[model samples]
Target: MIRAELPPYEGDTAHLRKMFSYFPSGVVALLANVGGTPKGMVASSFTVGVSMEPPLVSCAIRRQSSTWPELKGAHRIGISVFGEDQGEMARQISSKSIASRFEKIPLRHADSSALFIAQAPVWFECSFADELPAGDHTIALLEVHRGGADPELPPLVFYGSTFRQLQVSSADG
Candidate 1:
């Protein structure tokens, strides 16, 4: 094995950050009912289609997050793939104040284990499968029991510390 010493450079943090920010990702709000109370947080690193045979999706969350403890107890998880209109809700859930989160959003009970919100472009009712710690955050792998999306709705995207709405190109235009 061979290793080379890298040269020191200024603004390395900004350069590294810009590199990661170039990769756009969809935002998801994960919710779980713990002791009949709903706990949720917005995450930008959620990815779909981990496995096709059994069907799986995963989300990465920091180990020290306050919401992760309560959410882990849920038998299943509610995954809301946000539409463009839900960006406000995403910010609310991402806020440090937990007491007021989800106070304004309408949630419905789904799978007897999670809460589903209306108007989400895509929704998933998934059973908690397992979690693996990777550096500062844990990767939670979920088995997708059921999921669906509205074709006409657009997705909520996050990039470079800002939220973006997905624009579809229509052939008729």
Candidate 2:
């Protein structure tokens, strides 16, 4: 075995982020209705099917997020997995202006105050289960109360810091 000469890793934030961006992940809208206003944020760190028996999912949220403080107290939170055509929606919700995050965006609200984006490929109404401190972020574990998926709508992908769509191929080559 031969080892290739490479630069030593000094734990640079920029380089670490760039390396992390190589892995593709689906984007999701974590939202809820708080005080009659819709509060939401975009998260690519969402993981589904974490546990089956209790129906759990998780998302790593930045501790500095202004939205999380408002959302954590909500009775329920909505997780909407964006469809391929919803790239612009993700950007809108990710903006710094919290007041206008849901501007011009269609939504469906649950009785529990969970807000789901219209036309999302997948949706989950989750209750806050637990959270663990993870450096600059908190890993939030959510228990899914109810959820649904639309097979016709493919999920939006985030890779290399850009939005992408999935290309389906047959199993047989």
Candidate 3:
């Protein structure tokens, strides 16, 4: 079989964005305190458990993200794993409008360091450890401090261009 060569199409960044957005992903919110004020951004590229012995987790943050620098070296960072109900909150955090991100959203301080929100089904408070440059983003390695589970809620999946939830199965079947 012969493979066909594809022609290049030209457009703005939106074209590239729409192309990559096709991959479905889970939404997560990274929260940290900067100068006594809470700063957070929604992300979907968070990676999994790094070490089992020391209890560690990892995430990647773009070097160009405005909030990444402030979040780096934080004593504690809150990782809020969003449930399907938090789609609006995720969108708000992902938006460029910084002034209205936390508006109407309820957040609580946990362990005097990490900010925990009620909307998330699962979350973890991690202590800052080390980070190294990985391409255009920095791979942040964090030591787990505290975490909890909420299996009652379904995860919010980011697919194509929007957020979606898993369909529940009927018991009768």
lDDT of each: 0.85, 0.93, 0.82
- Provide the lDDT at 11 for model 1: 64
Q: What is the Cα-based lDDT of residue 109 in candidate 3?
A: 78
Rank by lDDT, highest first.
2, 1, 3
Poorly placed runs, candidate 1 (over 4 Å): 1-14
Best by lDDT: 2
- Which is the better candidate, 1 or 3, if ranked by lDDT? 1
Clash number for candidate 2: 0
lDDT of 1 at 64: 94
Residue-wise C-alpha lDDT for candidate 1, range 1-173, written one tens digit per residue: 89999766676878776777878999998888888788998989998889987898999999999888778778888999888888888998889988899788888777577877778889999888889999888999988987788977888899887899876678744
Q: Candidate 3 lDDT (Cα, whole model)? A: 0.82
Clashes of each: 0, 0, 0
What would the per-residue lDDT of candidate 3 be over residues 71-131, giving only the tens digit for each residue?
7657788988888988998888878998888898788778656887676888889887888
Off by over 4 Å in 2: 1-8, 170-173
Residue 102 CA displacement from its true place in model 3, Å: 0.7
By TM-score, the best candidate is 2
Model 3 lDDT at residue 17 = 80
TM-score of each: 0.88, 0.93, 0.82
Q: What tens-digit string does per-residue lDDT give for candidate 2 at 5-100?
A: 988889898998998998999999999999998999999999988999899999999999888988888999999999999999999999997778
